[model samples]
Target chain A: MAETTAPAMAPARPALDETLLAALAAAAGDESGGLTRRLAAQVRYEAAETPSRVRHLWRFTDPARLLPMNLTAVTGAPGDVSHTLAPSVAGAAATIDLWPGLPPVVALSDDLPAGQLTVVSAGETAGSPALAADELFAALNEAAWNTGIGLAVADGARLPGPIHVRVHASAAASLPRLRLVVGRNAEAMLVEQHLDGGPETRVTGHTAITVGDGSRVRHAIVQVWGQGTNGHLSVSTKAGADADVLTVFGVFGGDEAKLEVRTDLAGKGSRSEIVGVTLVTGKQHGDVHTTHRHLAEHTSSRIDFKAVAAEHARSTYTGLIRIEDQAHHCEAYQENRNLLLSDRARADAIPELEIHNQEVSCSHGATIAPVDPEQLFYLASRGLEHGEAVSLVVGGFLENTMAKLPDDVRTMAEAFVGPRLAAIREGSA
Target chain B: MSDALLNPANPANVFACRNLHVFVKDGDQEKEIVRGVDLTVQRGQKHALMGPNGSGKSTLAAALMGHPSYRVEGEIWLNGERVDALEPHERARRGMFLSFQYPVAVPGVTVANFLRASLAARRGTEIPVRAFRQELNEAFATMGIDPSFITRYLNDGFSGGEKKKLEILQMLLLKPAFSLLDETDSGLDIDALKVVSDGINQASGPDNGLLLVTHYQRILNHVQPDVVHVFMSGRLVRTGGMELVTALEERGYDWLTDEAAVAEGSRT
Candidate 1:
């Protein structure tokens, strides 16, 4: 696969230093800098072998936990993210990009209805911290991230389009934290993209979404990285009474990519649809762990994840659906399908359900198998080469997951990941 | 075994196959499916190869089409050009087409998209959307097939008869110089058979060649063949005109097998 060439648009910024990260991650700042203290502690905790609460082969280890020194936090006015936002979505909505060398930049459209949309830094708004203090991975991200973007939509307000966030990982580790709050009866869409960084760039990203009563939110997160990068990304969403959330996760490519997502439906009549797809090639390892917890009465949840692993790559998926005791009339379903493209590729899926409510309905299914040979020959006999046929099958599998995304976001996602998919196929061939 | 079969080139031939043998691997063992086949199709000619079940007729067609699963061990000449070493798509690009007996389905791929891509690859240029749509609609209407099938997944969930019709629709749209139909009439009713025959006739003009492989003589009635050859046990036993097809319909393949047996006994 072609190693992603670092985007040349980055302007002159403070050069990255090796010792700077060691110093920032090693020091426990004063009590006034409590966030820094927590970050320092989290960095140290990452050095040791910390067992993952979720059991699997994707246990995290040896990854840089602290934000890199000189990480750009682009904030306010035109920023780097505005440039990367696809032209199709450029003028549709407010755009932002969190660069490693600048502060989190946010540019809201002035022509929109007043009080309809608002964006603030974590300190400016009284937004609830999504990650608990005990969740070390997410806690460190929340504490150390300098680009914590807080979004709020007014009650009964409908956004014209989606908020596009393009984050560029740097040579050093970056902790990106997001807090989104959709007000009552409001609707919004969020398209978050993770762009590739340098060969040594390590990224740890965390996002928390809160859907208000009777509100709807559709979030699509796509990860596109370099050949020598390490990534740990987690997204946790909460839905309120009568609220709906459709979230799609597309893990396009990386050297070592670990994605964990959780959706908690705590309000009555809340619904959640979670879909994801991953493309793993080379010797990369891609893992996705998702959990859907139905904690309220009359709530429903659906989870579908698909992965295509080729070359010596490996894909692991573990999903669980937990219905609490108080949640009656809950309906939940979880399905995982993996396509292994070669003999060297490997895939494993584990789906589980825990229903404490006796009167609930829940089911989980998983399938892990090689790509169908019959389909390959069929396409090949029609004049496509074997490689092209395999590539088409893999692409169709990935595109099926995009059906959950909005039309604009899906188009952008395809434009973003299509070339990377071609690279994956090339490497496998 | 014969000098005629060993000759690899026929300048006036649209497609010439010389001593072609195809083998496929069953588990770890190599099995020769098409023992040896020599065929030649001239311009504007239709040759029918009829045989019973398991006679390797379809295997020979697949081998000539350059299917990867079959290891071909003979020279293939198309329009006086050597092309046995080429891949299937290469053969297709050089104007060779084979209508599969059981065309495989490609889920999530629409027939319109598949045809557009195949046409583009075959012609080495992009076809405008409007032009492509017009061509597809015309072909669909000509085949008596529903236009909605164009948007449906390619051959996915298609009925047996529908799949056969779609294959002929592709053959009509592609218009290859040399076409091989392997049991194209397998799942067609009388009406569809007539439509498909009309489509075939439209393609078989003065420049293109057609070979219709079938176990029954029902299709031969509509699409008359210039030459009819009876193939038994992977070898061509007899060749004649339309009278041979009538004879086979009247007596079946047993007579040909019995004649072959007697000829073998006499040789011994």
Candidate 2:
């Protein structure tokens, strides 16, 4: 039998911060923000409970409601903040290291939200312009944003090297928010990763990216957290006209995790391809939710996600591809495939397509299957014992999805997958 | 357990089955398909089992290979080792091979890769990449198969003749101690049949025993058998030399059945 590792216990929940709680209650009563306002109110009410030791276990199990709540809470954190709004910032910007262990946040000239793009360096400037926005100022409040690695490219500029961002949870936990924008005709590759190491392992993060017209961006996020850590990743992207975005998202390590990815193809000829794979075992609960919006005509999107569940572990995949009415001639496809290795393991895949445009082409497929006996027999007949045969088949199955990853990330993914399969085999035996 | 009953006449007789009876279960009733049949194949012996449809030829082959669908009341020995308790693939790893009438199509796995895996399992070791390729090429050449077919999905999109040839190729690579060729000549043309028969003859030698099951005497012409057994009503009624195949071809299965009924009537 495999050695049974004990589950790490997180510190009990903290008492409600009555001051923040009251602010949320008042904001909920206001009519302006609509859903955003209502959500703020709900989070306040939930936080009104007496101090308990839950530590967001509820969030781990139920991400549908908890993810947005966690976002509001993270954005509401009290502290120093840096960074600003922009219409377009040009050529050879400086490095703004907001959070060291966090992945780099590189914003192209087009990524600005309809205003002059700015960068305020909390750390030494590598060489770039800094501009701050009113909304960011208010959202950031008095908290000067802890600067993360930042780089800026000029309008119609195309840079070659991949910008690397790394986020780490220090001895004191902190919530960091990143807003990245790319400009029209600008192109760059962004590699963001979260690495946690400290006595205080519980940390949260929120990341939002915007891709502009005639621009292209490739984003890769790999999260490898320490044991007992609770990791929550919420990422949203907006693609512009004739723009292209490709994301290879990975979640390799965490005790309890919830990851949400939402992408909007907001303009014509916009395209996005997202591929992800997670290996979850033991009592770990890994939840992945993706919402893809094809909001304009001739937009194309494709998503493929796979997971392997074993032991008493559970994995849930919820994918939604929505094609709006104006998105005519849009093409969207989503597929979720999973392999279950034990009777105690559970996996749920909900692939949904909400198409409002009659001229659009959309399809979603999901499959949950155990190992094939004939394939197993064929391998076993080649003299592989049953376990070794199962290992080869499982590895081969996951390799199909892993092949979709880029070379650099593919090597790291194999390291994570290899041990997960071994642990699963040992657990079953 | 019982002095390991020795067959001194044929030391190469690697497989033997005694009083083999098999039944098909339907609802609550069981209908026997193989009735008290005894058969033996010495090593290097190319034997043919000729029978009409539904006369239990395939059932016997399946029973010997340990297919789960049939229930048997018998003893089967391979290399003087009891094998009725082993699974089909286990029987295979122990050097028993079956060329199905219709080979299963396994998608996403190439024919050459499948053969290498089977060979590895049979030998309990990994076959080196270079050596495996060389052997695969030799097998394909022996069976007159194009090299491109090795990279395609196993038996998928293959013509009937091509599937038969691939099956022979697998047999040659796996090289089982005892082989069951089940209806290998069912869907072949005259020319294809000769090529297939030649491949089978080249693969079968002094060390391996084969039970070639067929319904027609046409295949027998290309690959003459030392002994031919006739199946009737799920029973091996008569066993004789090559003359039995010729006689049955000149007459028919009904000729033999009618004679059996007459003899039974006279006895009563």
List lDDT for all candidates, in order. Answer: 0.74, 0.66
- Compare the candidates by TM-score and give the number of the best one: 1
Q: What tens-digit string does per-residue lDDT give for candidate 2 at B94-202? A: 8888787877666546676667767887887889999999998888888889999987876778999999998888788888888889999999999889989998888
Residue-level lDDT tens digits of model 1 in A9-96: 3222223232443333223111234344444544544543433333442332222322233343323232333334243364456677
DockQ of the two-chain complex in candidate 1: 0.42
Q: lDDT, candidate 2, residue A103?
A: 31
Error of 2 at A86 (Å): 34
**Model 2: number of clashes?**
54
Q: Tens digits of per-residue lDDT for model 2 on A1-429?
A: 122333433324322343443343232221223234334433543443321223222323532211111222222221122211110112322222234223334444333334234442222212211211112111221121222332344467666445545555432333444556778898866666555533335444555667888889887676666666665666677888999998887776666676767888987999999989877777777878787888889999999898877667788787888888888999999988887777887777877778886998888889887766666654543444566556656766666567787665666566567776675545453
Q: What is the lDDT for A39 in model 2? A: 44
lDDT of 1 at B28: 96
Tell me the docking grade of candidate 1: acceptable
